[model samples]
Target chain A: MSPPLAPPGWSRWLVPPAALSVHLAIGQAYAWSVFKPPLEAALHLDGTQSALPFQLAIVMLGLSAAFGGTLVERKGPRWAMTVALVCFSSGFLISALGAWTEQYWLIVLGYGFVGGIGLGIGYISPVSTLIKWFPDRPGMATGIAIMGFGGGALIASPWSAQMLESFGADPTGIALAFLVHGLSYAVFMALGVFLVRVPRPADRAAAAGGPSAAEGVRVSARSAVRTPQFWCLWIVLCTNVTAGIGILEKAAPMITDFFADSSGPVSASAAAGFVALLSAANMAGRIGWSSTSDLIGRKNIYRVYLGVGALMYLTIALFGDSAKPLFVVCALVILSFYGGGFATIPAYLKDLFGTYQVGAIHGRLLTAWSTAGVLGPLIVNWIADRQEEAGRHGSSLYGLSFAIMIGLLVVGFVANEFVRPVHPRHHLPAPPKEAADVQRQQSA
Target chain B: MSSDSSPPRGTRNGLIAFAWVWVGAPLGYGLYELVRKATQLFTG
Candidate 1:
């Protein structure tokens, strides 16, 4: 289908909400933990078995975004949003059927494989459109949309908990809840599909007149992966995410363990609170730090994320057990940087590669997230397990992991320093008149 | 391509506000719930 082109004076402000509709719906993936306990009890499964759907979903999110990105670019935001809506909402319905029937693999296939494609496509569908709309404030524009992904769990967690409480956590109730989610999100995401529009070519050309246009260096996604700059960014993103996600994945347990030997032992309720606080920080950092990136530039902001983030880990490792308040503050800052890293990266890609196929490039870059998603938890959990085996307790169990995170951050910092503008040879040559005419006609 | 057929300024303004409210209301509720939960970190 031809992408919808905006008439002159369609307010740019409308785009963020359109983007949010899909993001908030797909972002519910993070709230999978709320279902874990119930699913386990219902299916008589272990933690790892219950976690398979979420893990597969995340892995598929990366793979689909990488493979489907060019298709999204060619098809436009409306097509992408519609596809996301169909897949995401239907995945929930299929999961509902699976729950009712007590078939485990069906749940994985639905929520993990199909729903994950929705997540991947929905995540990037708005990115290039927003960047195009708000060329003057690309960081803030994309940040607003991406922040919804981080904040989605805030809504889904409490809502899901309340539903489970009301409906009971049995297979029937789970099926009912999934059914509701499927129908409701289908309705919500339809708004985005209806509202999205691509900037007209004239508008795009006008926006490209800015100074940072890098003399019109429009790197295609295939070519973008070839540059040293992309790999450097890959390392930068992987390390930054690895550091933050390690603490995030283990927040409740890590906090409790940090103070296990102290005067103020953390209660279960307080650990839950700590996790909520980190979620707030993560959401806030997406809008806050990414907007700051608009003013200070992407590279300088990442220096803070990596450099200052590593220092926060060092402080937590050394003095965390003694001071609860200090530990919380350090962790909050680090989590914020984690979120900021995600929100800011698309703007960073726009800066380095220009906006040619930025959505596709951004899609490919998310492989770093998939990598860190596995690596972060594995590092923290594996090390903590080994330390437990060695008779370590409290803060000692996590000190080695914290130190390793510091090393990883240092590596990321060096990678960020190595990033330069893409070479001119990588830039796409200007399209021939017939091709440009066909593109414009298709968009029209 | 400015058009005389465009909606009036007030209509456009109303749309902008409505769109923000559609997304913002849910996000606000989520944040309020999160803060309510997060308070336990200090009080608990």
Candidate 2:
């Protein structure tokens, strides 16, 4: 309940770097798939068995984020960051032990569940705090911090792969790799916890624009759910996530297969590099694309995302295994947009509803991610897997999946269009003055 | 342009606006796409 302290001389701009350090490190979750094939080969596991850790990790990310939203709002960013550091690092430790012991369930418990809590807490921690620091530009502040999440994999994918190769790619080697990740990240994320500071009362006073400022709206968490806007956004995010993750989870293999029949096919090393390129695109989109949303208005920007994204999915489906460059370009563009979406949504909510409890609102909204995390992959993977079983190769297996993605985008488009201005009726009256204004106007 | 040597209030506000725009725009575009693609899956 104490007022946050301000720095002696430094302006608030210093905080974004503090938030990014943790995000970039934890965002390494995207790079996790890089180790999948090696682990499978070494352990003699099937594709489904090999994918268990990743699947469980995704499930935990959504579930924990959904459940942990209020706790995060009540506790400040420091506590959340501390929990994230311990849980995330512990996940790696537990998984490392699991790897050494050759117990898959232990790996699931440690890496998937324990590590997942870290991912969720780290994601939400600095969001509202950053918004408070730069109230004039919530989108940009959150974007810079959140961008680290998408981009984190850019460092991890290749680096982890090298370490695995150097240490040996077998189970014991994998255990060592996990051990290093756990220890190193603990130190890296701790720096963010130390650096982060909530905006001081004066800054909040300045940013909140005083009592005379636009009577800022506050929506309770329980009531926010009742509004049509929340459901519309849920549909919008769920579909976007479903479409992007389907491709992301299978990026390496999908790229190789897509380019296989082309005149200039992607080689094995190139395929791995290609996933890295997508990581770059994902990272860049988080910074470049979402930041763009600040100018165009959130709704208008989403129109472009949904509309253009569907076209990109269609291009890949229609083009099939054709020009190699076209395939890469389109996939990169789509991936960038996917990253952009993750970065921009916080700002979008801030615009629609004032900053009151937006971090919690954003947390509630992430249930869409949990839903899509399962649904997107299931739709795409199941279709692709079944078709592969049916002897469908080349572009045939993914055609149905791409079409499904398009359908999801269209549904989101309708929901986006449906968003009306949140009426005064939906808001609680501003303290006294606004209520007096209403009384005066009515008497007149 | 103002004849006065002093910076105008409008100019300062504009600069502040531009800073916010630069940072927020890309993320706005990005989240819009996320929602678009999310809904697209079900409709199609």
Candidate 3:
């Protein structure tokens, strides 16, 4: 059956809020840390044990996104958003049950596996539709939606913390928090599902002559994965993300370690402040850098992100402990690049491969994030632990990690330089009956 | 892009306002925390 398009009177601008509603709600994933300490104390689990739900959720996010990408493209945003709502909210409800029953593995299955699928699907649910709706400003359109992901934790952190504080951190309290989160997000995401509308072929045809012109080689997701350009970008995204996450995963502690020996040491509260600043920088950078991409072009903006990103890391590696403000400013800029990297990539995919299956392609590309999520934290934390064990103090503890980050950013910069337009051979040929059949089977 | 097939300006305006408020409520809350945290960081 053909999908319904926006009515003649529909406003394109409303689509962004539809996207943001889901992104903002699912972005609560980032706030999982707020529950960590409480879960550990209440459940009598170790830090690593308590972290299983979150870790598994990330793993599931990548896998589900990879497996579900084509389905999202085939099924449409409303269907994808509905599935995301069901899986995501139910994951929370199930986690609530798990918590109440004191079953750690159930929490892992509920929040990790089930909720992770919600995250993956919810994350990519709006990309292609948004590109179609605002083809003239794909970057800015996507930036607005993706920015909510970065900002999700900011709202969730305080809210979840307050819930835990008010309701008590015990299993019942945590379960109630989960229940509230699940139900509210379900309602929030439903708004997106209702508001989202697919662009009809007629609207697309009308758009072709104007700012929304289709001027690039369009590849199907299956063909896109086969192109060298996709892998190059994969390398670029992975390395850039790895470099940023190295600092992010350890932001609070890294700041304290850097300023430990200063005349006025950074207190724990101040360290938390540093984290909040990074979050703000991250959110700001998404909208700021992405909108700039629409002006300067995507490639140029990425050069700034990857190349200048390396320089920012070098600044910290050399002069980090020399001045606290320098450290803070450098960290903020690096974090902005991190956020920008994420917000820009969907638009970048649109630029390279066109909007045909950009959402599915994007879903596949997120595996890089899942990979970087592990590699980044592992590299930084492992090195930091070893340094501390060796009695290294202060800035030296992280100096090595920062230098390594510089090297990785430079590598990603080279990869970005090598990224070229997808070759014509990779483009999906004019749709034929047999080709449609093959495509259907492939997506199936 | 031309608005030949688009909604009226008033409807668009109302929608833009509603859309902003819908997403902005949560985002505004987040920004409020951001401001609070920034204040704590700089004041000390």
Question: What CAPRI class is candidate 3?
Answer: acceptable
Task: Quote the lDDT for A113 in model 3.
Answer: 92
Candidates 2 and 3: which is better by TM-score? Answer: 3
lDDT digits (tens) for residues A1-444 of candidate 1: 788888777777888999998898899999999999999999898999999988888988999899999999899888899999998998899999999999988899989989988999999999999998877788999999999998788888888889988988999999999899899889988879877888865566455453335425689999999999999999999999999998998999999998888888999989989999999999999999999999999999999999999999999999988899999999999999999999999999999987779999999999999999989999999999999999999999999999999999999999999998888999887567534743565465
TM-score of 2: 0.81
Q: Residue A14 deviation, candidate 2, in Å?
A: 2.2
In model 3, state the lDDT of residue A80: 89
> What DockQ do the predictions score, one after another?
0.48, 0.03, 0.33
Tens digit of per-residue lDDT, candidate 2, span A1-444: 322344433356646766876787778887787778877887777887877877788777777777787787777777788888999999999999988888878887888889988988888888878887777667778888888787566567656888898999888999999999999888877766765667654555455454223226766556677889888888888877787886787876787778667776666666655665666677778777777786777898788778898998899888857776677788888778777778888877776666667777888898898888779878988999999999988778788888999999889888889876566566765557545643454454
A132 Cα displacement, candidate 3 (Å)? 1.0
* Pairs of residues clashing in candidate 1: none
Error of 3 at A106 (Å): 2.0
User: Highest DockQ among the candidates is held by which one?
Assistant: 1
Cα displacement (Å) at residue A351, model 2 = 1.3
Weakest lDDT window of 10 consecutive positions for candidate 2 chain A: A1-10
For model 3, which pairs clash? none
User: Which candidate has the highest TM-score of all?
Assistant: 1
